[model samples]
Target: MVDVVACGELLIDFTPVQQKEKPGSIAFEQNPGGAPANVLAALSRFGKRTSFIGAVGNDVFGRFLQQTLIRLNIGTKGLVLTEEAHTTLAFVHLDETGDRSFHFYRNPGADIMLREQDVNEALIAQAAIFHFGTLSLTHEPARSATWRAVEYAKQHQRLLSFDPNIRASLWEDLEEAKALALKGMAKADIVKLSEEELAFLVGSEDVVEATAWMLGQYDLQAVFVTLGEKGCFYRTRNNFGTVGGFQVTAIDTTGAGDAFVGALLYQLLEVGESMLDIPQATLEDMVRFANAAGALTTTRSGAIPAMPTLSEVKSFMEAAR
Candidate 1:
């Protein structure tokens, strides 16, 4: 059985890099990206069997992304290549603090073209967890496809993992985006959100209050709010706590949150439905390991390339202690 199955956008990220030949000029480095894909990459690094269900263009970038997944040992049986549109591209701009923003080149990218027919029900049924993000909900056929897969996974009793991973600029209406994200959250068994996303969704700055509201609002097993280098706040129905982060001199924050989600899911999958009953200490340790994974991803540059191996995360955590 597949350990995890993710359905959503798979695209290229053009991360800014310093041009060595010309010191003042900057260059863009192509990296395999997309929140769902990055999460699978992180899981793959930890020796989990993962599969992707999404669409890409029948172009160079699409081919590259497919190969990247294969190289990462993630299954591609559900990945589709289409001629209708080119692959999606995002130019990443990093500030002095390694925090980043994106400018997208996807008016109708291939990812958005994913049809309900492209969704692999068999793949979803074979997985222990079904993971997705809201990016695919921004457009048509992909939106329907995502919901179809979600329903199928739910019917099969698979754990549903969600990350809103909202890019407000991609939406025509922020409120619409918010609604869809909340809709997805309501369906998820596990959810991960950035600090900004938590505030945006809950309309509260207090993590404790917001998480309480979320647990009360949704039929969720657990909710994680990632706070960059400060680590994460997590809450389940019965327990809640903060996990302190590892201090890392981050060069790029890309994929860090996905790494945290991946690591947390890896641990959660070990216990399955019992995750809801795990002790607060067990939950904190899981988040601590996930925080280490996220911090380690930032020490490098790209998304998939930067994800640490299982051994690397273990060694980093050991050394930090």
Candidate 2:
């Protein structure tokens, strides 16, 4: 059985590369990206059986992304190619701190063209975890298609993993975005949030309180809040604690959160879902391991390319300790 099946956008990220020949000019490099795709790739890197379900345009960039995912060991059995739309693209810019800002080129891009009919129920039924983000919910048939997957996962008793990787600018109404994110939380068994997203979702500045509120309000099994370099804070029904981060000089913060999510899901798959309500110490250790993966990802560039293998994450953790 597949350990995880992720559904969402599959696109190219055009990240700026500094030029060596030109004094102050730079060029763009196409990198495979999209939160759910990144998560699947990271899980694949960890040797988990993973698959992705999404649509990409029938253009060259779309083909490239599909090929890249397959090469990364992710199952693309449910990948769709639509001729009606071009592939989605995002232009990413990094600040001095390596934090990223995005300007998307997905005006009716193929990712959003996913329809409920395109979602393969057989593929989703084979997974222990079904993961998704709200980015797919921003438009049309893809929105309903994502919701359909959520329903299928719930029906099959598969764990639902939600990461509200919100791109507010994509939403026509910000309130609608928050509402959709909240709806996703209600269905998720495991919810991953960045510090900012957690605050926005819970309407609080307190990280611990936000985690607690989300778990209780949504009656979720567990909530993990990523705190950048400080690592992640996890709250389960019976236990809660902060995982201390591994030290690293981050070159690009892009995809680090996805790496963290992927690592945690991979560990959960390894340990088995029977003990998901882990002891406090066990949860802390798991988050620490995930933190190492996320940290290592930041030390590199791009999304899928930056993901560390299981051995790399383990080695980095061992050296840190």
Q: Pick the candidate with the highest lDDT.
A: 1
The Cα error of candidate 2 at residue 169, in Å, is 1.4
Tens digit of lDDT per residue, candidate 2, span 1-321?
788999999999988788999978979888999999999989999999899999999999999998998898889888999998999999989988888989999888999999999998998999999999999999999999999999999999998999999898899998899999999999999999988887787899798788877876886988888888888888888887788887788778889999999999988888775435567777777889889999999988899899999999999998998
Clashes of each: 0, 0
Candidate 2 residues lying further than 4 Å off, grouped into runs, are none
Of candidate 2, the 10-residue stretch with the lowest lDDT total is: 271-280
Model 1 stretches astray by more than 4 angstroms: none
